[model samples]
Target: MKKIKLIFSFILVLLVAISCTVEGINEDTALLGTESSANLNKIFDISTDNSGKVTITPTADGAVSFKVEYGHGTTSSVTVQPGASTTHVYPEGKYTVKITATSISGATTEQTFPLDVVFRAPENLAVTLNKSIHNLKVKAKADYAKSYLVYFGDVPNEVGTPLATDGEVSHDYAVAGTYNVKVVALSGGVAKTEKTTATIIYNAYGLPITYELATQNYGIGGTFGGISTAVVANPFPTGLNTSATVWKYTKTTGAETWSGSYSPLDSPLDFATGNKIKLLLYATEVGKSLNVELEWAVGGTPANGVAVLKVANTVANSWQELVFDFSTIAAIPANAKFTQLVFRYDDSAKGSGEVIYIDNIRLTN
Candidate 1:
C-alpha cells in the first residue's frame, strides 16, 4: 500500500507541475534573464486579439528583430514579455512572406505564408466626333481621349471600324452631294460605336460658264469680216440697233480718213436727232489728229463729224470703251439695223504715223 501510494503521489505531482507550466518556458525555476532571441521569433502566433497581428521579440544578441520575405510582406519580430502583439497589412496579391526568429545565441528559424490578391480591369469605351460630316472643303471636328478610338465610316451615319489607333481622320466625298457620317470608339478591349447624321450640300454654281455674243458682224470666235459695204448704201443698215452686237465710230476728220481698207458708212450722219457713240483715240503728232467717224461710204461725200470721238497730242497708245445713248434719231429712214461697224482714223493733222485698233462694240437695251 505504501509503495503504491508513493508511486501515485509522484504521478500526481508530475501532472500538477506539467499543467501549471506555461508553453515554451523552460523547466528551470530561474527568472527570465535579458529577453531571449528565441522568445521573440513567432512567424504566425494565434492571438487573443482580432485583426491579424504577429509579434516576434529579438534575441539577447540585440533587441527583438526579424525580417519579411517577398517585399516586407509579413510581420517583423519584436522582443518583449508574454502576450505582447503587433500587426501587418498585406495588399491582395500572390506572394509569400518569411517570418524569422533569432536567439541571442545567433540562431534563427523562418516560416512562410502564401498570400492571395486579385482585381478587375476597366470598362468599355465611347467615342464621338465634334462634327461627323461637312461639305467638301469644310473642316470636320473631332474630340480626343485615351483608350477610346474614334473611326469614321466608309459611308455617312454608319458605325465605323476601330479608329483610336488612327486618330481623327477626314473624308471628302467625290461628287457634290449628300453623305452619311459615323464615329466609333474602343476601350478596355471593348468596342463601343456611336453615330450622328451629316450632310454635304453644294448649292453654289460652278465657274467658267458660257455666254453668247450677238452681232451681224459677229461670227463665232471673234471679229466681223468679208461682208459687203453697207457704207455707201445706208451708214446704218436696217436691223441691228438694241442688239448685243452693233455700234459705230465716227470720223474725227472730214468723215473720210484712210485711203485703203477703211471708209465711212454714208455721206449723211443725222447726228441732230439724238445720236450717241463712243471712241478711244491718241494723237500721231503736233497739228495731226486721227478722227474716227461714221458716214455714208460714198466718194467725195460730205463727212458727218458730229459722231466722231478723238484724243490728240499724247498718242500714248492707250484705249477706252466709248458708249453711245442714241435715245433720239429723228427719223431713221432705212429702218436700219445700225449694221455698219467701223474703225476710223483721221490723219488730217501733221501727225500721220498714228495708229489705232478697235474691238468689242456692244449695244444693249
Candidate 2:
C-alpha cells in the first residue's frame, strides 16, 4: 500500500508541472505581438512630385520595420526600419501604395492609399506638312503626349486651338504665301512647343488658260512658217483684245495644213462639258473655208478615232472670232485628253502663201 501511494503522488506532481509549463508557453505566445487600427497614423510624411517621385515616412509604436510597396511591379518593395523616410521614383501614373508595418515578433499589418504622380511636358515633338484639297495638311507627333495643339500662323481663326491625339488637321489659307506653323504637345495641360515655316503655292483649279500661257506651254508649230509676235489689228477683232498678241502663220505649199501640239497637260483636259476652241482669224479673202480638228491620244498615241469637227470661215478678210464646238462631233470619251490642235484651209490655190493672223487661240470650259 505504501509503495502504491508513493507512485500516485509522483504522477500527481508530474501532471501539475506539465500543466504549469503549458500555461507559461501560452502566456509567452500571447505577449509575442500586438496590432491596432491606430497604426495607420504612422503614415505621417507622404508626398509626390510631377516628375514621378514619391517620398514616404512612417512611424508607429512597437514597429520594428516597414515594407513599402509601390504597386507597379509585383515584386517591387522596399524594407526600411521604423522612424525612417524612404523615396521611390515611378512613372507618371496613378498608383496604389501599400505600406506593411511589421512588429518585433514578425506580425505585419498592411495599409494602402492612393498615390497620383502627374505628367510632365511631352518630348521629341515633330511636325509634318502635306496638301489636301488645296489646304495645308498638318500632322504632328510626340512621345508621351495626351493631345496636341496646332497654330497655323497668320490665321486668327486657327491660331490656337486644341487638336486631336493623332495631331492631324487641315487649314486653308486665304492666299498663297509663306506662313509659320506651330505645334504643341500637351500632357496634363503642360505644353512643349515647336515651330516651322512652310511656303504655300496657289493652284489654279480648272481656271481658263490665258492665250499667252497656252501658246507658251503648247508651242506654236506646223508646216506653216514659224510664229511672229504682232499686235492685234485695230477696231479689235471679235475675239482679239487690245492687250493680246497674235500668231502670224503664212501657209506652206505642200498640204496647206497647220497645227499646234501640246504636251501632256498637268491635269488632263476634260472634254465632257463646254469643249470649245476659239480663235480670231484674219484672212485675205472672205468665205475662206477651213477644217479645225481636235485630236486626242489613246495609250499615248494621238488618234482621230472620234469624228473631227470643222467650222468654216463664212465671214473673213476682217478679224472674225469663231468657235468650234467639239460636242458637235462624234462622242469622245468624257475624260478624253486632246493633245493636238489642227487647222486646214482649202482655198490654198487662192490664199496660198497669204499671211493669216491668228490671235487669242485658246481652250476653254
TM-score leader = 2
Model 1 C-alpha lDDT per residue in residues 224-313, reported as the tens digit of each score = 222121211122222222222222223332223342133222222343433455433222233334333444423323333333444343
Work out candidate 2's RMSD over C-alphas: 12.7
What's the TM-score of each model vs. the native?
A: 0.22, 0.44
Error of 2 at 223 (Å): 28
lDDT of each: 0.36, 0.60
lDDT for 258 (candidate 1): 45
So what's the TM-score on candidate 1? 0.22
Q: What is the Å distance of residue 141 in model 2 from its true position?
A: 2.6
Residues 1-365 of candidate 2: C-alpha lDDT, one tens digit per residue: 99999999999999999999999998988778454323553342333223455677766677788888877767668888877878776666777888887887788878887876766667778778885324788777777676677787866676576777775788887765557777877664444555566645344322143344322332333344332233333334444445355555555444323432222333444565457777777777766565666555545433663636555566555677778777665566555666555555653343345557666655666
- TM-score of model number 2: 0.44
